[model samples]
Target: TQLLEQSPQFLSIQEGENLTVYCNSSSVFSSLQWYRQEPGEGPVLLVTVVTGGEVKKLKRLTFQFGDARKDSSLHITAAQPGDTGLYLCAGDKSGGSNYKLTFGKGTLLTVNP
Candidate 1:
């Protein structure tokens, strides 16, 4: 079975602060995706990384894929109170169907105002 480990299961930071969360695994994946979820709502996909060493940025958020495709990282620059939510990282096994995704335990972040 494929498994993903996310670091710092929980985090609390004041608004405007910055933080970085990590996701790692022993197995290489064909693709990886990041998502953010708010209470009472499903997770919203943030970005997807397929190529090794790929880096993607979305406004204040940045994502990086490991060179070996076994890990990923997310960096939030100047977090806002609105950014408080559950962050998730999911990986797709190399040979699995497109819908088959293995999700990490998730990291809960609270950005206090």
Candidate 2:
């Protein structure tokens, strides 16, 4: 299996709708970071969850880290055109060559206004 993966790959929703994107991995990670990117721009860190079963909320978005620290999820309470962007989940190993993060291919979310 791929070390890390994201479901749906793509999601399209109308404004005011809700959606959840999932990230999974077979190997455990020391930490995980979620990032969002708009067109032509680099991804901006939304949050980082390092503890098992930890949850973090930001405005309309919520992020959760798996109890095993091997997976995570992002939930958008209400969709908006401004929410359209690329969502990425990255696992941080933080030691030796493992310090580099392994990213999920990415989830492309489009919210129609």
Candidate 3:
């Protein structure tokens, strides 16, 4: 099992505030994926970084993958109540044909208006 750790584990912020969450692992991955999940719902894929040192942005959210592909981070420009949910980082340990995804425990974010 891959050891992926997400910092803070939990985050609580007011609406319009900015925040960032991080994911790190000792094992190098072929690709990384970020997902957000709401209560009683499956995680929704937000972004995927297949190349090292890649950066992706979705609206007010920014995602960055480390050059070594061992770490990643997500930053939100302005927190919103609608953005409150569980953020998960997944790493594809086995690339290509044998794709295996290892997931982090996740970071719980609560944005209050």
Candidate 4:
């Protein structure tokens, strides 16, 4: 089984709406990262949460790490057409040695203008 599971594999909303995506895992991770990817491009990191119970925000996006460091959530307010993309969550368990990331399948979001 995949280490990370993302909910709402796909989402469709109108501009100005709000949405939330979730990533969950039963195993603990040293760090978790959120990324957004556009069509024909790679995923760009949006936020990285290393500390448990940590929260980070970027513009209209909010990211939170679970207190146990096993899960994370992403919230986006006032969604825009530009916000449409593939949202991905990845977890790192390397003890500062190998830099391998376990990525979730990804959540696809589509915002209609």
lDDT, candidates in the order shown:
0.95, 0.92, 0.94, 0.95
Model 4's TM-score against the true structure: 0.97
lDDT of 2 at 46: 94
User: Which digits, one per residue and each the tens of the lDDT, describe model 4 over residues 1-113?
Assistant: 88899998999999999999999999899999999999999999999999999999999999999999999999999999999999999999884876799999999999999
Query: Which candidate's TM-score is highest?
Result: 4
Per-residue lDDT over 1-113 for candidate 2, one digit per residue giving the tens place of the 0 to 100 score: 56889988999999999999999988898899999999999999999898999999999999999999989999999888999999999998763466578889899999998
TM-score of 3: 0.96
Q: On residues 43-75, what C-alpha lDDT tens digit does candidate 3 reach at each position?
A: 999999988999999999999999999999999
What residue runs in model 2 are displaced by over 4 Å at the alpha carbon? 95-98
Error of 3 at 28 (Å): 0.5
Question: What would you estimate as the lDDT of candidate 1?
Answer: 0.95
Q: Which sections of candidate 1 miss by over 4 Å? A: none
**Compared with the true structure, what per-residue lDDT tens digits does model 1 show for residues 16-70?**
9999999999999989999999999999999999999999999999999999999
- For model 1, state the Cα shift of residue 48 in Å: 0.4
Scored against the true structure, residue 49 in model 1 reaches a CA lDDT of 97
- Estimate candidate 3's alpha-carbon lDDT, on a 0 to 1 scale: 0.94
Count clashing residue pairs per candidate. Answer: 0, 0, 0, 0
Off by over 4 Å in 3: none
